[model samples]
Every structure is written in C-alpha cells, then in structure tokens.
Target chain A: MLIWNRAKILYIKKINWHLCLIFAAISSQPILTSMTWKQVFSSSIGRKLTMGLTGIFLITFLIVHMGINACMWAAVYFKDDHGEMFNKAANFMGSMVVIRIIEFGLFFFIFLHIIQGYMLTVYNRSKRAVGYAVDYGSKGSKWYSRSMGLLGTLILLFLIIHWLHFWIPSRFTGVEEVEYNGVKMHNMFALMQTTFQQLWVVILYVLGCISLGYHLAHGFQSAFKTIGVHNKRYQTMLTGLGYAFAIVVPFVFAMMPITMYLGWVK
Target chain B: MEHYNMSLHLKVWRQNNSRDKGHFENYKVDGISSEMSFLEMFDVLNERLITEGKEPIAFDHDCREGICGMCSMYINGKPHGPWKSNTVCQLHMRAYKDGDTIVVEPWRANAFPVIKDLMVDRSAFDRIVQAGGYISVNTGNAVDGNSLPIEKDKADASFAAAMCIGCGACVAACKNSSAMLFLSAKVAHLALLPQGEPERKKRVVSMVAQMDKEGFGACTNTGACEATCPKDISLSNIARLNQEYLIASLTADK
Candidate 1:
C-alpha cells in the first residue's frame, strides 16, 4: 500500500511538470512583445510614411536637377563660350563618386515610391468593393488629388523616357566627351539640344513636365502634412510654398526643352 | 423662413441583416416641406411604409439636432448629401430640387459592416476608444477646472478637436476608407491638454495599433474627410496624430 501511494504521488508530480512546461511555452510565444520593425513598416501608416519620405527626397532631387539644367540658359550670359557653365556642372556631377552614390540612392527611392504608390492605389480600390452610382468628380476634392494614381503612372512612363534620352547615354555609352575648364565630362548640353530637336520628343517632355507640376502641387503640402506639420500658420505657409514650387519648378523644366528646341540657348 | 413643398424619389439601401446582400428600394415622398430636415423626410417615408404594412427601414440616430453623430447617410455620392459641413440631421429639404432623385446608402467600409439598412456595427470604433482614448485617473469628485490654466489657443484647439461627434462620414468620404480623421480627432483632443500628458505616449501607440487591427485603410490626405466633416475638423489633426505616433514609436522603451 505504501509503495502504491508513493507511485501515485510521483505520477501527479510528473503531470504538474508537463502542465508548467506548456504554460511557459504559450506565454513566451512573441504575442506579448511590443510591435516589431516589420509591424511598424507593414502597417498602412508605415506605407504612407515610406511614400512621404521618398517623395520629399525626390522633390529635393528635382531642385538639384533644375539648378543644373538652368545653367543651359547661362549660355546666353556667357555667349563667348556657350554651355561652358552647364558642361562644367554636368562634368562635376558625373565624375564625383559621392554624387554617383547618391544617384543610386535616388534610383532606389524612385522605384520604392512607384511601387508603394501602386500598392496604395490597389489597397484603396479594394476598400471600396462597390462603386457609388452617382459620381461626384472634383466636388469633394480636387481632380488632381483624387487622380494621383493616374498622374503617378504618367510620371513613371515619362521618367523612363527621360532616363533613356539622357541618363542612359551619359552613364553607359555613346557619349562624346567635352573639355570644360581643363576637365573632361559627358557633353550633356549637346545631348539635350539634339534630343529636344525632335518635335515629338519635345512635346512629350512638355507634357511630362505638366504632369509633374500637378503631382507636386498635391504632393508637396501632402508630404509636410504626413510628416506632422499641423499648425495652422505653418500649414498655410506650406500650402503657399507648395503652389509656388508646383508652378515655378515645372515651368522652368518645361522651358528647358522648348528653349533648346527653338535654339534660344545658342 | 420660406417653405417650399416638393415631391422626391428616394432610393434607400435595405438590408435584412449583416450577412444578407442588400439593394436599393425606391419610395416616393410627397408634400415634403422645405423646412423639414433630411431625417424628417425619412420619417415621413417610414410612416408611409408602415401604413402599407411593410417593415420600416432601420437606421442609427439620436439627438436629432446633429450633436449625437449617429445619423449617417451617403446621399447622392457624397456623405451627408451635397451640403458641405452638414450632417443629415441638419440638412434641410430645401437643398434638394422639386423633382430630384436622392440615393441614400450606409457608410461603406470593411471595418464598418452593415447591421441593417443604414445602420453599421460601429463597435470597432468603441473598441479603439477603449484601447486608450481616456485619462487613467481615479474617479472621484471633479478637480477645479480653473486650476489647470490651459493656454487659450490650446484650449480652443482642443475644443475644435473635441467637436468631433464620431460620425463615420470621414470614413465614408475617404476613397481609402481611412479612419485617420476620426482617430486623429480623438488623439489630438487628449494630446493637447495637460491632463492627457501622463499616458500620451501609450495612448497614441495603443489607439493607432487598435485602429490598424480594426482593418481600416490608410490615409492618403485626400482632404475629403475635412471637406465633409460636419464639425469642420481640420486635416491638421491627422498630421498631429502622425507626429504623436512617430514620437511615441521612437521613444518607446520597448
């Protein structure tokens, strides 16, 4: 009887151990941990953050690009040596290792922005399984704001064309080198002039610039708002600046192709 | 006030239950006074339907003066009809023409499933609010409100945010069906005052987590929420919510 009692007590102890082990495993299953990096980035807000950050970076790149291209007009100021300033700037940008590294980063951001933009568009569409019977186009928000997906798609196509015209040739092959202030650089100015000479290409370029302007008109203030600039005064200022940027930047970009095509720089 | 009598054709959604597929059923409402509110016109329609021995349409409503935020309707492709910053309860019949065809639907979002014709199970919103939408102080006699000495601008801003009645019109108007405007209004209202500082970090994080978990779509800053808001809630509240979330996430001890 004593032996049987001892054996029964041992069996109960063994069952208790198993129960403890199961409880421990269940409690430690990562459900109790705070949000992970994957959770933060995969959330809807995270996707918007990615879009806004990449957009701001691309906006900055546009400013630098516009500055460099504006040097084409400087040919008029320094008529003795047409496009000297422009060539010099282009050569510096092309040769610098740091700039080249940043160019890669810019490419990465552009692709990221495009991919995330499409993902968001798809997600937004799926949220509305049924379309409204009565359409209120341009009544609730601006047409451009609601049409961001279409505008972005247009920008992507234009970007591919723009890269083929200049970026590919300059970076890879079939580019004549010019001496600018005792330094050799890809002759981007000559390339631009020749590229713009085609009427179809020039027209496409102008249309691309217009699309870009509308995209920026909405995206500029949007990026700021997304990043948490919520004060009324600051919001008003940002909106004003956004309008100016939307008009002036694209206007300048559109002019580059037109002036080159018309031989205004020469 | 001038009253104009009008006859209108109303096509309203009728759903028996959440699981049942819904469709629009047309009803003719005659001799509706221009002075009658939009919900009153619906009341007239319901009276006619009941008289004919048909089941009355079910919708959510309280405080018919527009403060309760229960009245939700998607009228003519716009939430709360074509009038800006107007709830259906406040929308007068005068806004419609003599022979207009008005289509009404419920707030459509995966997060807000339909419970009946025009009513949705918005307990998801209540869950989000329960997550961290309040201060954690012990309940007792109220503190002297004057002792806080909150800045006038801050007070006003908080008041503006507090004006949100939790009407899901922002969600209805958003193309993405995002609850950012509504969530931000709650977050901003608490985050602005000193009383909310104790749990500020935890509140924003938990509420946003709850929001995402509820399966709402992301905000794209389309401005439709602000445009359709009956209380004129600003889009800036969304920006403030984003800021709060970012700060909390970066500084969180976990």
Candidate 2:
C-alpha cells in the first residue's frame, strides 16, 4: 500500500510538470511571434498599417502644435500681456514630464513614418519592373496622391531645418530665457520672432507649410479610410472635415511666420 | 450607319511562356473598321498571323460582351484602355485615331505571372476566393428567398459589390499592385447578407490572410483602382473590408 501511494504521487508530479511546460509555451507564443521582425514589418499590409497609425499620430501632433503656436495671436487681442500667454503655454509644454515623454514618442513615430514611406515608395516602383510607354499623368488619380513620396521628402527637409532653428537650441543648448513669476522658461516666442526676421527663413517656413497642407489633404481622410471608416455619411463628413482641417491648420502655421516677419503681431 | 476604316500600328507584348523572355513585336493591321471592338481587332491580327504560319499572340477572352472578366489587356499606360468604366472587349476602336500607335501588354504584377503573351495566371484570385469566399450552409431544400428580409440600402450596396467580375484590373492599375479593392468587394458582398452571418468572422479573417499570403502589395488608397475599375466598384468597399477585418481581429475566437 505504501509503495502504491508513492508511485501515484510521483506520476501526478510528472503530469503536472508536463502541463506546466505546455502552459508556459502557450503563454509565451505571443512574445515569440512579436519578436519576429519579418512577420511585423515585411508584409505589405503590415507596412501600410504602420504608415496609417503613424500618420494619424502626426496629424494629432500637428493640431496640438498649431494650438500652441496660435497663442502668438493672443497678444494681438490682449496687447497688455505682450505675448505673455504664448510664453507661458510654451513653458508649460516644455516642462511637463508627460508631454516630454510623448515628445520622445512623437520623434520615434516620425522616424518610423519616414522610413516606412520610403520603403513603400521603393516597393511600389519595383512592382512595375518596366515603365509604361505612354504617360497617364493625373488621369488615374489626383497628382498630390501620387506625389506623396515627394511631398513627404520635402516636409522631412523642412522639419530638419525647423528643428535646428528651434528644438535643438531649446532642448540641448542655452537659449534666451525669461523668468516669468520666478519660473525661468525658454523664450520660444522671442526665438520665433528672431528666426522669422530672415526673408529666406520665412520663405522656407511658408513653403514647408504648403507641403504639409498638401500632405494632410490626402493623408487625413486616407488614414480614416485605411482603418476602415467607410460609412457613406461618415465618409462625406470626414472628407469635409479633412479638407477644412488640411487648409486651416497649415494656413494658420504659415501665417504665423508671415505675421512675425511683417511685425504685425508685435 | 456609316463605318470608317483606319490603318493602325500595334506594339504587342509576346512571351512564349512564363520562362521565356518577352519583347514588343510590332505588327501593322490596315483597313481596320472603327466599329470593331478592341478584341475584334486583335482577332483580325491573330487571323492574319495564323495565315502567315507565325505563332499567334495568345490572349484570354470569353463572353466577348464583357461579363466574363477574362479579357485583360494593358493598352497604352492604362488598364483595359483609356476609357472610363470600359473593358477591353467593350472598348471600340473608334476611340483611336487613324495613325495611332497602340502599345498593348499583359497585366504586370509579381502575383500575376505571365502565362503567355497577354494571358496572366490570375489563379491567385481563385485561391483568394477559395480561402473563404463562401458562406457555410448545409445543402438541403432551397431556403425561401423571402425568408431573409434584407434592408434595401444594404442589399443595394451588396449588389454593387457583387458586380465585381474578378477582373484583375484593380491590381494592374494600383501603383503597389494591391488587391484591396478586389478582396473588399468579395467581403462586402457576403457580409451584407444575413445568410453570411454564421461564417462572417471567419470569412474576413481567412480571406485577408489569404490575400496577404499571395504576395500582393498594400493599398495606399490612391483611387487609381476606383478610377480604372471597369465595374465602377467604389473605394468604399475597401473601407468596409477594413472595418470587417478590424472587427474580426478583435472579436473572433481565432
């Protein structure tokens, strides 16, 4: 009887060990699958999904950016403060830990977007091994839709210049700081005013905004369409909103440099 | 009725098989009637080639009235020629000028390998369809047509999607050679109907997996597919497919 009981306990232990092994393997399946770079990035659909998600995130970032920059116009309405509101808003954004973390995410997403955009463009070109004998330009689709790669590249160049002018100095190097109520903050408003003073700089900013407008014109609704928002009524509404947002946000961004350069805001 | 005759220069792609190197072999066909369809003109060219004891250009065509969706020819730079909502079979020669040089070629995509000169193996489409294109139901006495009362708008939308003839025009027209439009059409056709409810989740997931497996490119929503679609299939169908796939991915057991 004692021998049988010991044998039964040993058998139970073996079965439990096997069950644990199976369960562990099953639970680790997702992690293993995610570790595969090819499964995530190599497929065409995977690349597209990445593009759409990143594009939408960038669009959201643009809205927040435009909102902060529009604070310059607050001085125009409230003349007593002299762009104080804009400075405070800028300082709060720079100091916040959460926003700072998100800022890192934003850079990561932008880099991914750029890399994926170039990859898709190359893949698309390779799909057509030979060029068409006759050019069917603009007849098949909108010129802007086909020229996303070009527009995206232009925007990327603009971003580098803009970052050099503002972001790099504000973050890493010392910049003109203003102490407002004992809180020392980088005077981004002053930086913008000084930067826009140059005619070439102002022109480049405007051109960059124009490229952004065209990019958003196609990208806004396209992201929605990509993720499967296809109701006719909703589509019409999204398209209308897209057009308005594309034109309005970029226009506001472009106007800031112009107004600053012209000394209208001051 | 009056008919006008014109002489035309043709640069058609000729590949003996999938392995053979293909090249443009130019042939001149004179006194061609403007009333003849594009395929009819090809038939005239093929007849002449046969009489000369030369290897005739092989192309796919059946149901010359355009419903079969078998005829695919890349004319000039556009798929199915330069007309809107027109297939190669339905495209009349009158659209061309007397001294025009028409460049004809096969649908070029990695997924669509050339079987001959103008015939591409579109069996990728068949495999995609086989992946889960049908609803699951046991065969029995026919169910009453009126048993399921579908909404009018939904039915209309489904019918529009069902109009897809499985022609690979959308694939050929896409810059990326994506088949989202085609796959979406198939998904929407069944998803709109009540009979398709049981297998709806499985259908979308499996079909999309199959589509990706076939080595087709991703859809960028450039609208070229909608623009060049002979059936005038909307890009909205693609949106529906996306919606379906997302829902399935989240809710389906698999």
- Candidate number with greatest DockQ: 1
List TM-scores for all candidates, in order: 0.91, 0.89
* DockQ of predicted candidate 1: 0.28
Once model 1 is optimally superposed onto the true structure by TM-score, how far is the C-alpha of residue B243 displaced, in angstroms?
Answer: 0.8
Candidate 2 positional error at A58, Å = 1.9
Stretches off by above 4 angstroms in model 2 are: A1-46, A77-80
Q: Per-residue lDDT tens digits of candidate 1, residues A1-266?
A: 44334433543475553333233222321221266666667777778888999999999999999998899899877867677788888888888899999989999999999999999888877776756666655667888888889999998999899989988888776688788558677888888888989999999999999999999999999988888898889999999999899999999999999998888897
Model 2 residue A164 CA deviation in Å: 1.1
Model 1 error, position B102 (Å): 1.1
Residue range with the least summed lDDT across 10 consecutive positions in model 2 chain A: A26-35
Query: Against the hidden true structure, what lDDT does model 1 obtain?
Result: 0.85
Candidate 2 lDDT, A158-192, residue by residue in tens: 99999999999989986898888898888888888
- DockQ of prediction 2: 0.24
Could you say which candidate leads in TM-score?
A: 1
- lDDT of candidate 2 over B138-170, digit per residue (tens): 556998978889999989999999999988999
Q: What is residue B246's positional error in candidate 1, in angstroms?
A: 1.0
DockQ of each: 0.28, 0.24
